[model samples]
Structures are given as C-alpha cells and as structure tokens.
Target: MTNSTAKEEILGRIRNAQKIAFSGKDLASSAGVVTGTPGEHFAVPRDYERTSDMPREEVISLADERIADYKADVRRCSAEPAEINEAVKKAVADAGAKIVGIPSGLDKAWVSGLDEGKGEIRVDEGLGVRDLDALDAIVTSSAVTCAETGTIFLDGSPACGRRALTLVPDVHICVVPADSVVYGIPESISRLRDADPTVPITMISGPSATSDIELNRVEGVHGPRTLMVIIAG
Candidate 1:
C-alpha cells in the first residue's frame, strides 16, 4: 500500500484499539494499555436536553422573524416543474458561477439549458475532493423546507448527490417546491423520520456564518459563502 494508505490503516487500528479500551475491554494485546484507568470515561455523551428560557410561541415568533429577514429579498412561487429550470438558470446567472451536477443529475435537461459561453457546465459523478475543488457552485433539490425559518433540507438523495457539493462549493443553489415547505422544524421531523434516517440531511438557514469569537460576525468559514434558494413555482 502507499504510504498515506498505510498510515491511515495504522491510524484506524489505533482508533479501534482506543474504542475497545474505552468500552471497558482489555486492550493489552493491541495498544499495550490497561483498562480501568482514572480517565476511563472517554466515551462521549450523546443524549442531552437543551433548556431555553423563551416560551414556545415566543421562540416560534423569533424564528418567524429571522425567517422573514432571510426571505426579505428572496422570492417565492407556486410549486411547478418548470420553475426548477428557471431557478437553476437564475441562481447561476445571479452568482456568475459555472454549473456542475452529480451523476444522476447528468441527464437533466435543466442542466443543458446553462449558457456555455457565460460559464462552464458539466455533468459528472466522479466529483471527488479534487473535482469538487474545481467547481464554482452546486445546484440541488431539497427533500423539504421549513417555512417558519426559511430553512432548507438536503437529504443526499440521488438527485442531491454528495453532501459536500452543497457544502464545499462557494455557493449552493437549492430548489424546493412550495408544497414541500412545512410549517416548522417539528413538522419536518416527521417527514425526515419517514425518509432515510441514515441519510446525512443538512439543515441550512441562510449562508454559513458564525459569531464565536467576541460575537463578531464572519461568513463562509465552515461552509458555503452564499446559499441561494429557489422556490419552485
């Protein structure tokens, strides 16, 4: 195996050994380490409830206001098939970005509608790390949306292929049907549970941003710089 591959294999073995040790198993054979040490509770806690001071309706109102702010310049329309093509074109044109789709997205006639003169358009499934680096933007369809927060959900369906495309690229253009827009996140939970539970669903509200340091705002640090939404009419 190559050096990188061999190193990764060794690292995986070490992680497995650590897991076995942390799970109260004897890992003397693997890592020459003993169990029942003082820092043995290496396991991460998964279940925890968050306490919020704001009441339910107040919280809902807050979310509603935030959604309104995000959707201010954003437009909406009735759910229709034709709007998909229109939205894709509009997002690409607006961003001045080239378009690239995943494997299943290749045959989409909407993709062919892109202007090659203005930007490059390609349909390829082999969008590995390197290929992803070359793309300017990714367009996808959502499984659902939250009208209360103007949030969009991408469940990595075949049409939505590789989650990174929606995340890694500088811009993400997601198309959602108006009918698919639910009242709130709670309403989305039911639909999500019915869909593939294992699918990595990304809930995005506006663009990637954070105010961690001194509460100062910064955008596109962890995800896309711009999140464009197209409400299919």
Candidate 2:
C-alpha cells in the first residue's frame, strides 16, 4: 500500500522467483546456475579454416596490395640479404632520414648500405624515450602480416624491438619477409602463438591517424605518421 511496503513486496517476489528458478538451491551455490566442473575441458567447434587456401605468392601479393591501399608504401625486393639491404637503404634515403633507430638484434646488414655521411644508424638496446624521438625514423622487422586486414604484427622479437621504438618515431620502415605474410587474422594468431605465446604483440593497420568531430583526418597523433613496408620475397 505505501512506498516502503511496495518495495518490500517487490523484493519478496524477486527472492521467491529466484528460488524457484534455481530449483530451491542456494543462489550462491555453483550447482544452482554454474554446473561446469573446475578444470574440465570441453570440445569447442573449430569449423573455420585456420588460414585461407591461397598460395604463398598470392598471399604476399594480396598483402602488398592491401598495404598499399592503407596508404602505406610497399616495396618489393628479392629475398636475398643484399637486395634487402639495398631496399632498406633506399627507403631511408627516400624518407630523408638523417638519423635512424634500429633494434639491437636487427641484422646490421639491413642498414649496411646507408652512407654514414647521409644518415646515422643508432642501434636501440635501451634507448630513452627522448633518444628515440630524436631519431628521424625507426626500422624494424615484422613477425607476421595479415593480408586480409593489411595488418602487421610485432611480437617484440629481437628484430621487432621494444614497442616504444616504433611509437615515438615519425617514420617506420618495417621489413617483412614474404613468407611471413598470412591469409588472415586466424593464421596470424596461430603463427604468432607458435613463435612465442608469452611475448606481447602489436598490430598496425596503418600509420597512426585520427578523425575529429568535423571528420578532419589528422595523422601521427599517437604513433608514426609514415609507414613503409618492404616485402622481401
């Protein structure tokens, strides 16, 4: 009849309904609503294909196309180390990079072609944030790339380096092996897990860009403004 009484009635009804719904068992009991045993394994349906059936060459081509569509530069080079070095050299030269940061374990040969007078190469072992920002660009290797999404995955491997190295630099030149390009996200994840499940993964769709309320697109808000991918096959 009164507000207090009505509230009490509603609460009582809710309790009764819960008891009936739970078949008179305690609501907190695991058996009441949750019945799965601890540590029990259940078979999950994996009807989807782990990866697309496209051939390796086709996958790489699709990845290159998608990467270009994202407005990122894509360069193709022979799989040979020397050619890769030349490609890296050209990418840096085109960016007009005076100072470049590279991961500690990255192949020194990649930057071997860079002339000391034109550009300085700094290996990032444990560089400070400002140190990385001062560099003209950062060069690293990708663990895997997804052709479907035009995404690159970095798992902090020796070649990938720390996350900050990529975030602070204005230009990022990622060297991706053609074989590392996968058909889709599922295949990418599978490959990454097989590589190192515990390592952190960073996925880049494109150079960092954001749209404001008026739909004005601005680039390089949080990460590199320019992304160049060298697909070495």
lDDT of 2 by residue, 30-59 (tens): 455544566998566688878688888889
Q: Count backbone clashes in candidate 2.
A: 0
For residue 153, model 2's alpha carbon misses the true position, in angstroms, by: 0.4
Rate residue 69 of model 2 by lDDT: 85
Best by TM-score: 2
Model 2 spans > 4 angstroms off: 1-39, 194-198
Clashes of each: 2, 0
Q: On residues 1-233, what C-alpha lDDT tens digit does candidate 1 reach at each position?
A: 99999999999999997888799965564676534456566655535432334444454444445545663225444455556676677778888786554436533654556756767765546677777777787777778776666777777777666577777788777766655666656667666776676778888888888887699978889888787766654
State the weakest 10-residue window (summed lDDT) of model 2: 27-36
TM-score between model 2 and native: 0.83
The lDDT for every candidate, in the order shown, is 0.66, 0.89
Clashing pairs in 2: none
